[model samples]
Every structure is written in C-alpha cells, then in structure tokens.
Target: MIEEFVREKILNTYAKRTTKSKELWEAARKVIPGGAGSGFRYYEPYPIFLKRGSGSRVWDVDGNEYLDYCMSFGALIAGHAHPKIVEAVKEQLEKGSMYGIPHEKTAEYVKELLRRFTAMDMFRLTNSGTEGTMHALRLARAHTGKDKIVKIEGCYHGAHDYLLVSVFPPLSKAGPRWAPTLYVHGEGIPLLTVKNTLVAPYNDVEAMETLFRKHEGEIAALIMEPVPMNMGLVLPKQGYLKDIRKLTEEYNILLIFDEVKTGIRIAPGGACEYYGVDPDIVVLGKAIAGGFSAGAFGGKEDIFSNIYPLGHAVHAGTYNANPVAVTAGLTCLKHVMTTHAQSQMNDLGEDLASGVKAAVEDTGFEAQVPHIGPSGTVYFTDVEVVDYRTASTYDKKKNWEFWFSLLNHGVLTPPGLLEGGEQWLVSAAHQKETIEKALVITESALREIK
Candidate 1:
C-alpha cells in the first residue's frame, strides 16, 4: 500500500502553499475545460497556476517559487524569458506581430534550420507541430501513392486523426506484443481514420518488417519519434534506427522522423544528427522557435516539390510562416543555442541523471533514471524500460508520491499526464548549484516514500 500518511502530509503542504492557485482554478473551470489550457497540465488535485518565469525558475499564483524542470514541456531549452529570445520578440512586436503576406524573416529562419539539418533540402513552416506532421504525412502519401501508414505503438506524432492510433492503450485491449492492435486514443476519432494506421512494437526490427510485409504496398510511410519523449523519453536501441531505415528503403516506404520534441533539444540536427541516420522527412517543433508556437517539415527536393505552385498537392495556411515566430526562432538558433551552449546543457543533463540515479540507489528504491542529451525520465521500476510495455510497469502510487513530494519541496517536473514515467528537462539556464539542490530534494522525496 502507498504510505497514506506521507501522501496526506505532502498534499496538505501543497494545498496550504498554493491557496491562491486553488481559488484561480475554481474560477477558471467555469470557462476553461479542466481549468487548464492543455490536458497535460492538470493532475489529480488542481494544477499550480503560474504567474511568470525567468531563467530556470517560475512563480505560481500563490507566489511560491520553483526550480522549473518542466520548462513548458521541454520547449524552453534556453529557459523561460531568456534575454536573447525576449529581445527578439520585443523587436519583432514593435515592427509588427503578423503580416499575412510573405516576409524576409521567413527565408532567414528556414536558412538557419537548413544549416543545422543538412538532410533537408527545403522546408515549410506551420503554426504548430500538429500541422507540420499532418502536411508531412499528406506529402508522403502523395509521393508514394499509398493509403496506409505504419506507426510505433506508443509514439505520439500529433493530435491529428490519422496519427492518434495506439498512443497509450490498456494492455487488456492492446492485443499481442509483436503485432499490436490499434486502439483509438480518445473519442471523436473515427474508426475509418484508424483502419489504415498500422501499429508495430518499438525497438523490434523484425516485428516492424513483419508489419511491412503483411501490409505490402498499401503502407505509404512509417512515422515515429526517433527518441520518444511522449512515452517518457524511451531511447532507440543500438542500431535500431539504422535497421529501420534499411527496412523502409527495402519496402519502398517513406521514413518520416517526428522530431517535434527531440529536435533542437537533442542536437543541432536533432536525432538524425545524434544517431547518424537520415530520414525522408523530419518534423521539428518546440525549442526551434524558442518557446513560440511553431512547426516545420523538410525533406528531399523531389518530395516537397510536389507541393502547391509546383505539383497537385494542397498545403496552405494563412499563418504558415508568422514573422514573429520566425524572428524568435532565428535569433534562438543563430545566437542563443550555439554549439557550445548545447554541449553545456548536455553535460548538465548527465550530472542530473547521475545524481538522481545515485540517490535512488542510496534510498534502496527500485527505480532507474535514463537520460539522453538534456532530457531524462525517472522510471519507478527495477527493470530496464526499453519501450512503452516495460515503462508501463512502473508503480503509479509511488510515482504520485514522488511527484507530489518534489512539488512540496520546490521542484517542478512534468505533471502526471503521461502514465509510463515522468521526464525532467535540464535547461541551458540551470546552473550546477540548481542541479545539486534538485538532487537533494529528490533524495528527500525518495526517503519519505521509503
């Protein structure tokens, strides 16, 4: 059983500390569904309503400060209100917010992205990652002339109907391991939408090949997160990406890497550069715009050439390349997020991971902290979490205890919207002292659970 006393104590402390947040939540629920903008921001009790942030810290409505690791769900890699990003946005705002017509910043920003991701010949910008992935899939289907698409079991591309299959299904309804059944993640997703989307186990090349063979020429593309963050930062096993690339080529299937979360955070070129594997299409979002709402997709010239004004495909948006977002993104990529900054952030991530792992061991907790680049997750399990299946075995009650304890002690990780594990993102603004303090808090939380 969960330590009821410990749980109650932490909840009591949190409730007392954030009295203003509770009041705001009650007022917000009348208009906003679930009292929050995104479903991921809510929790069992009420979510903490934030007021403002600067650097690696944030203040809630109650004025309680926290060393923020959530970092806008891993989008603010340069940290909240970084001076460079703030100045860029301010300068752009003074000039203008949006111009429906084309602007010079659009080309300037795309050039910076292309410089990092050399594999992409040309790219198109959208308002968000969802739009980027949606257009990318349409292009893939048009280029290959196929209707079906294959996706990893737990990988999340976006909220679009076509890619929402088998995100986090119950094991009882998940079918088998190798050939998993596709279950619609939520309501409003039509049965016809999921019929053509195939599901395959992550980290299993043979299973992926089997799905390809079974579907044959019907499958147009296989889109997945090179290192899945939605399922708690599950890394691709050794040679897993390379093998998948070969298999896709052999089957004449388009390989699209949905790097929405991993892009710009993992490396300059994202997973393709870190893993040394080139995909047909790469979808980027999050940190690319330095916390602004933005998305981009790029690939070989032949595929994107099929877009409007060139071919028959239709891809258009009024805010396709918003000048404000482009200016902020360009400033972040060209100035703030340099090669040296990425290396420093990565080293900080390693330090945080090691420190947390040591604390777990010292406390005799059956847990593991797996990290890559600047992101990591704390899995409350003894076994190695290779994929979603293993990650699902984590202890939920312990997870809640750990998260609540951290919050009570002034540290903020991701709210428990995702079930498998909890991820902590180290930002460029976090100093070594901040990491040490977080580690100390983690040890205290683990001890309280014990």
Candidate 2:
C-alpha cells in the first residue's frame, strides 16, 4: 500500500517524534489488543495518542499539533473543550457523577432532543452508537415480529451481530456485481446472522422493492444511514429515503434510520430534517453529544415500550446517563439549537467540498470532494459513488497517494484509507479561515500526489 513505501521515507524525517508515540503504543499493546480501544484505530503506523484538543486542532503526546478534520470521526462538533460545555461538566461533577436512577440532566437532555424531533414521543439513552443501533434493531424485531432485516450494501449501523454483515465484503469474492454475497464484516458473527440480512444497493429503489417482495414478511426493519456516509458520503437520490419510508410502512416493516453519523451533523433533526423523511426509529450518536461518547434512539413511544420492565426487549447499561456525558450532551445540543449550528456546519461543508474539488481538478487528476451536511470526503477519482460496487471501482492507488500526502502536510484524516476514501468532517469551530487553509493544503497536496 502507499503508506508502507511512504513510511520508509517519512519515518526518517520524523523519526524521533514517532519514537515517543511508538513507546506509548508499546505500553498500550500490553493491555489493549490492537493497541487501541477501538479496532478502527489500528492504522499503518501506531496511532498517535492525543494529549488535548481545542477548536479545530489536536495536540499529540509528542507535542505535534494538527488541524484535526477527523473530529473524533465526526463526533466533536463543538470542538474540544468548549468553555460552556466544560462548565456544565464541572457543575455536574460537583453534584455527584453516576447515580443509578434517573437524573435531572437526563430530562433536560431529552427535552433538547425532543425539541429537534417533536414527532418522537419518548427516547432511551445509551452509551454509544453501537448500543443504540443494537437496541434499535431489537426493538424493531420486537415491534414487527419478524426475524430478518434489510440494509443497503456497505451502509453501517453499528458493530452488532446482525448489522455487522456485508459492511466490507471483498469485491472479488462477493457474488454478482449487483447481488454481492452476504459476508459478515467481522469474525464470529454467525453465518446464520448473515443469512438474515438482505443486501440492497443504495439509491436503488427498484432493487429494494424486489427485496421487499422476496422476503416480504421476514423483514423486521429496513435500517440504513440517511447519507450512507461510511461508504464515502453518498447522498440519497431524490425520493430514495421517501420511497423506503413509504414501502416500509406498506409492508409493516419498521424503518430505522441509522443517523449515528448524520444526526445533528446534518440538522437539529438530522437527515430526517434534511430529506424531510420521518422514520419510525432514529439512531443517533457521534455528534449527538458534541464529540463525547454518547448515543440515543427515539421513536414512536409505543415501540420503545416493547423493551423489558415495561416490555420484552432487554437493554441495560452501567453508564447509560452518567453525569459527565449527560452534561456534555446537554450543553452541546443546547448550543447547537441556539446557534443554528447545523446551518453553519453545512455552509462549511459546502465550502470545503467546493474548494477541494477546485484544487483537485486543477491538478488534472480526476478527484472530487462529495458532501452532505457537515461531513464529506475527497474521493481520489471522479466516479460518482452510489453503492459498494461503484465505490470499489474507484482507483485506490491514487486515493492512498493523496491520503499520505495530506498526512505529510499536517492534516490528519480518518484512520486507514479503508473506507474507499477517508471522510472529512467540518465542525462549528472550523471557521472560514480554517477551510481556506485546508484548501491551500489540499491544493499543494494534490500536486504532490500525482
């Protein structure tokens, strides 16, 4: 890959700087498999340990500063350590951190979410997007009394047993170009589980209609990302989301919008607001708590009531509403609401996409930055990606070349060039000046890539 060849030369220039980061990795490897908390962090070189973040920057343990477009993989919209959020965290800490029962902050946080999604009658808080998607799927199955699910190919909801199928299937072994074989994204996710997942290409409503007919009563829910950003920021074609919502209602299959990445990043109401499609269930995470590890699922309250104690689906957590997260989330959501932050972030997103496209085309290379809401990516080819088949067809050699060149220029993108292309997130903190600087860096880097 491009990183290996570059590592030989790049490491020579930054040898000593990488040493301390290497040492941290060595120590971490003893306790954490992959030397990182999340498997996503296992990159070419050991990942850098972050010491702090403020605004649109992160300071590594080796004291290297970078313009962090990673944004905790699109988690931190308010940026690191916004003073208002810090004050809320401090105040909440003084009142005691973790209480086993419901707290006042939970009500306040829910209210903020309710304001954005007035259609939701109730919601349940969770610790991460993974849990949110997992539980949402469970609730979906319970409500509809079905055993299978339908998801757009290459779309990711979370790392659950059922949803973890076909996220990154190998193109060579993947059956037909149109009907790729269902393979689990990770090991130990049962083949039976994989069998239960119906794969349909994104933006293909006719294909989805065919699947709806094939497995009519077996499908519990149709879960997917509103923008399918994980497959490299492909926006839904006009009427795509609306068609799915309509079909799911017709078939009695629950419609779950996995807005974990798109939620609050697209708008206060998320992709639902952006596309004007109201799903029965919406799974939110990432930016939901302004970069903190927080997640939630809100729907028609009757569906949520299917969970145990009140219903049959079982979900529990030690830190479901831990004060630190709740306080951070409350502050972040409140700020997003007041500032009309999604509009600001969307403006930045458009500028970033436009500037990057202008820069890349000037290099005479077929590259473009595609975006929706506050997030997007620089695909190294001009191909309009809509589904996994198209995304896999892009020239990956040029893509990774651009990736490493950008890294050398001091811009940290998403870990691994594995997502077909890396995603770039625009934060409320990344003002006009920041976008311009990144554009300049992008232009110079594009020249270096070819």
Candidate 3:
C-alpha cells in the first residue's frame, strides 16, 4: 500500500534498463548475494545499470539520463571520467598496475596529503574504507592494549563487524537513548564483537563522558564522523566538537575521525578544516582516490608507530595504492586544491542548501536542509536529529515520495528511504545550471508531497 504512493509512473531510467538489468539480475542472483553490488543501491523495481557518466550526469545502458546526486556514494568529487584523473590513470596504467614495491610517487602522494590534512602523518593505504578502519581499530587496540572501542550510534564507519553494530537497529528492541543495545547490523557478527563496542549517542558529550568513565581502562578509542553527516547532515552544536576532543584526550582515549565521506570532497583538509577539530587518527576513502577504490589511515608518529613495517601493526592489501588508484587519488587531490576549487564547490553547496530550504518551505513542509561544503543531505522530519534514536524518527513515507519523485524527475539518489535520508553530493563539475535544474526537480517533488 505504501509503495503505491511512493512510486508514480514507471521511471524512465528503469524502463530503459529493464531488459539489460533483467538479464544481469538473473545472472547475478546465481552468484552475487544481491543483484546489485551494494545493498543501498538496490531499488524495489531493480536498479539501473550505468553505461557511462559525464561531469555531473550518468547514462544507463538504455541511454536514460540522470543528474546523479549519489556521486558514487560520495566518491567522485571530480565527477566520473574527470579528465585529469583519466589522464593520470591512463599514464599510470601504461607504466603498470601494482608492484607491491613502494614507488617514489607514493612518497609524493603522501607529501601532498601531509601538506593538506596536517593531521595525517606516517600512514598506509588500503583497498577500501572497511579494511582501513579494520586495521586502524587493530592499531588502536594494540596501542592502548584495550579491547573495548566506543562508537556513535546512527553513524556508519564501514562493513566490518566491530563498527557495523548498532547501525539502524530497531528502536523497539534498542535500549535507552543514552545507552543503545549492541546489536549487529548483519548476520555474521560474533557475540564478542557486540559486547566489546560501547555505543554512544552522537553529539552528546555527556553520554560519551559517562561511557568513558564507566568503561575506564577498557576503552581504546572513540571514533566518529566529525560532522555526523550520516543522519542526513546533522551538524555538531557549538563547543560540542571541542568538548569531544577534550574529553577523549582527558580519558586517554584516542580520537579517530572517520572522514571516509567528508575527506577530500569537503575540502583540501576534509572535515577537520571545515570544523577545526583535530583527531588522533583520520581515515579517508572514496573521493580521496578520485573515483577509484582506496582508503587510508594516518596519524601522529606515536599512534602510527604501533603499525607494521614500522612497529607490530599488520596491515596489508593486494591493491593498496596500486599505481592506477594512486594516480587517480593524486589527480583528485590536486584538482581539489588547484585554483581554489573547494571554494567553488563550497559556494555551489551554499546555493544548494539555500535552494533546498526555500523549496521545502515553499511547500509548507517541516524539514532540515543540512549541508557542509559540497555535501548536503535532506531530512523529511522537523525533529532535531541529534542522535540515532532521533534520527530514526524521520518521516519515511514522505521521504520516499520525495525520493522517488526526484528520481522520476531525472535525478538519481540512493534508495531505501527507511534506512536513512537521501545523501546529496554536488561535485565541482556540477555547474550553476545543473544545481538550478536540481532545484526545479526537487521543488516539483516537494509539491507532489503537499
């Protein structure tokens, strides 16, 4: 019944991809657990298989066009097929892929990153954020000699068991808002993993303080997204970030900022620059390596000393900073810093925030259009989404109407309205006209809901 109102006429993108996707889905079902690569991208009517993407738009196999807000789930800050990145990758591919032997370019890459992030020092790269976070956790445990780790509810770090728990767990079964049940997000997480992680509400320094004291020596690190952008752009209150930093330091707890989404996309220095909160260990992925797969964990010499090739930390991946990925990452990084490109993107993001706010208000709907730099997310409910519990209270029905309506109107966003709100990403490639076009689509979608 709910699906009826959520879906309007057949999405042209879906219609065009139907034949190809049906063939692919049938073949994929026999091997892949899900027909899609990621669970979040799968839609009820099936997902559109992309053929190619331009600056800010993507075309499916059926040749249907969409103004992609997904942006490869916050990866392509340069947009797909960015010329500089393309050239870099092509040049690197001509040289070779991987040697497992470190190259001079690796040091150059590290130096550029060091110049920008400032928080990163002495680091290693991985194939994905999951591997990077997994290794980072291991290092934290090794450094502190502690088994327990503190994480914020509603914030997703990666697919690893340690961080996967308490991600969008059912509130009926969840414990208090201050104290949440350590429920694993999926099937295979061990009982011990849930027991080890202490879930704290995001932005609530009091809850974090209580947990730190309660756990005492057991807690190794307290990691969180600096801006808490997962719950559709929930910003930190004034003094909240500074307080978190102070408390973590006071408790002898290592502060880790999971900047996987906000890394290079938000600014040259990532969210650390955007908010001015420095963390002990900062993890990055997605846009950090252009559109390629890569993740990195870097920190001060003290903490990084616990890792391998330096100390005892064992972190290795087959494709860690392969030449192609390194080239892509370097290209993206340079693009973000060159010509003050982030300033351009941030300005566009401000315009996007204003447009979304005006569109929502024009429809007389209570919503929050939270944004930071080039990243923005739309929330359907008016309730202040401070933590996981409050984040779950969003209006799903209306969100789906807005989501599907936007999709039908030629914009592509992540599906699963029940999971969370639509994450909006505008690239440097997204021009003023593109943003205005998105505003037109978004405004129409909101009017449909009213």
Candidate 4:
C-alpha cells in the first residue's frame, strides 16, 4: 500500500510538471517508433524532451531544469555544450563536416587516442560504438580465422548481432550459474549469429575457462566491458581482469576490452590504465568524442593489418572520420579531458556516489551504489550486484518509484523503465556545487519513498 501511494504521488507530480513533454511524446509516438530516436530514450511516463543544455544542467521542453546525470549515456564527459567542444565543432564546421576523403584532424585524433590507450598501435574511426565493436570482432575473426566469439552475460557491446546475446535476459531463461544459455537480446537475429556467440558469466574466471575449454579453437575472441556499465557498472573482482587476460592468452583467444563507456571516463587510459590489464584490442567510443558520434577500435598493428585496402577484412564508411566529429574528439582529448580534468571528474564522481549511498542508508533503502571514476549506478537490490543474475534481483517497482521521485525533484538519471541497468555520470563540467545540489535532491526523494 505504501509503495503504491508513493508511486502514485510521484507520477502525479511528474505528470503535472511535464505536461508539455507529455504532449510532445504523444505527438512523437506517431512519427517515431518509440517516441524517441533510440529505444532506451523512451520510458513509462514518457521521456523528457530537452531543449538545450549548458554546463552540468539541462532544461526540459516543459521548462524544468535538471542537473543532468545521464550525460548522453556517459558520452558527454566534457558536459553539454562545453565551450571547448563547441568551439572545436564550430571551427570544424567552417572547414567542412564530411569530405568522403581524408583530413588532417583524423590522424591527429588517432594519434591522441593511441597515446592514451597505449595498448593500441593503430586505430580506425567509426560513426558509433556499434561499428567499432562490429569491425573489431570482424578483425578478430579475420585475424584468427575463427568463427565463434565469447561475450559476458550482461555486458552490452553496442547493437551488433555478434555481441548482443544475453544482455538483460530474464533470470528464468538465463540457464545456470556458471554456464549461461545464449538468449538473444531481441528478435531478427539469425540462429547462425546466435550459435556463433557464446555466453559466460562476468567475474567468474572458472566459467570463462569452462567455455574456453568447451569451445577451444573455435572461439575467435572474448569481448567484454572491463567494468560493465550496461549492467549498471559492476566492477571486476580483484584480479578478475588480470586472470581473464592470462586465460585468454593461454587459450589463444584474443581479448577485446569494450571500453566504449570506460575509455576516457574512468581514467585517461580507461580500464586499461586503471586496472593495468592489456587486451589484444581496445574498443573506444562515448567520452572520446565529447558528445559527438564517434567510435574507434585499435590494437597491435599486425591485427589491424587485416582491415581494408591492406588486407581481406573490409572496413569502410563515408562518415567514418567526419572532420567535425574528429575535431570535437581531438579537442576533447587534448584540451578538455586532460589528466587534471579526469582527476577532478573522478573526485566529483566519488562525492556523488558517496552521497547517494548515504541517502539510501538514511532512508532505510536497500540499495547499493557501485561507482568508479565519473560513473555510478543506484541498484535498489539487497544482493550485492556482482553479475547479471545478481543485478536482475533488484526490485523494479521500488526503483521506478525512486527514479520518478528523483526526476520530480529535478535530478535526471538515465531514461528507461528498468534503469537498474543504467547509470548516472559526472562530467568534467560538474563541480562540488552541482554534486551537492543533486545530493540534496536525492536525499529528499529518498525520504519521500517507503
């Protein structure tokens, strides 16, 4: 009864304040598939449509301003309309957006990426993270002459078919503890694609080895988010990443770290630098472009030698390194997201995560906030979220109530119904003041819930 009352109250407040957004959503549903550009952007009570954003804040179409924690799903590390990013985009805009040809900034951008990633010798740019992982997997298959791939159960590696298996699958159908069944994320994926993909539980080295021994030479590579953000930022157990790296090497399977979310956000070198575990290939996106659409996959020169004009594995895109996106990315890496900026954001992220954890405790909420660097998630689960099965045990109704209350209180989390799998990010633009503001709102919302 209390849960129902709290939920109704929050929903009423949201509906009252976001009438304009509601109307826009109603109109958008007619034209767009899910009333938003992406499936994740739409939610139960209609997603908020933002007009514009500045440092640390976004104004909704309904005129409500929020301390934007979504940060474009952790892509906007420099924050919304960051002055440096804006200037870079404007300057590149004058030069030209797309050239169907090579430009100077593309090489400059890759050089900076190579410096940061350290493990990657050569790099190729793509339009989105999906393309990066897609090409990286294809390169793996081509290089190893293997057909199958292994992916973490809950880790998401973009929209491609190869790595799309078992992301957020129902616990009932997810099979056993160590060995999980291959459950396709959605329909339209052919059985051949599903058959070629293998699933292993995250953080379980034994399970990973089990799959490796079971598949042996058939597996091309094992792709994973070193610290998976898709399942709401589950950190690898101590030595988990190192063990995986060693096992992959022993088994002759290439290790691909999908650092698309973690690349620039966790640290300058991302999980590779943070954890000191080097993989065969590093897939990067999100914060690398500082809000622009960009992705890159790179590793040892010999591996990437398979891509295009050089070798058999084909890779081509007209907008692969569109000058504008590269300019934004270049400026972000060299200027905005410097070592100091990364440290500051990490400090702020720690504060935000601490505050959220405190609020949960004070409000007697059974929840956990697992954070690293500039990203964290509020998992309303009693069980510690270590893997997909544990993460799925979270109370969805209570999470919905908590999310709605936070939204009503002017704090925007990631958009979705079951956002237990999503996270809140702190951008470089966020300072102590913005974090304090969010904490106040978070505490108040926590108190309002049961």
For each candidate in turn, the TM-score is 0.97, 0.95, 0.95, 0.97
Candidate 4: tens digits of C-alpha lDDT, residues 1-450 = 334424676788988999999899999999998699988887775788899999989999989999999888888989999888898799878877789988888899999999998988999999899999999999999999998999999989888887778998888999997999999889899888778899999999999998899999899999999998898889999999999999999999999999999998888999999999999999999989989999999989999889887789999998899998899999999999878888999999999999889988998988878999888888888898889888888777777777888889989888642463788889999999999999999999878877
Per-candidate Cα RMSD to the true structure, in Å, reads 1.7, 1.9, 2.0, 1.7
Error of 1 at 15 (Å): 0.9
Question: How many clashes show up in model 1?
Answer: 0
lDDT of 2: 0.79
* Tens-place lDDT digits, model 2, residues 223-258: 999788777777777788898889888888888898
- Error in Å for residue 187 of model 4: 1.3
By lDDT, is 2 or 4 better? 4
Model 3 earns a TM-score of 0.95
lDDT of each: 0.88, 0.79, 0.80, 0.89
Residue pairs with colliding backbones in model 3 are: 307-313, 308-313
TM-score pick, better of 1 and 3: 1
Model 4: per-residue Cα lDDT at residue 444: 92
Local lDDT at 149 for model 1: 92
In model 4, which range of ten residues has the least summed lDDT? 1-10
> Whole-model lDDT, candidate 4?
0.89
| Superposed model 4: Cα runs more than 4 Å off | 1-6, 416-420
- The parts of candidate 1 lying over 4 Å away from their true place are 1-6, 417-422
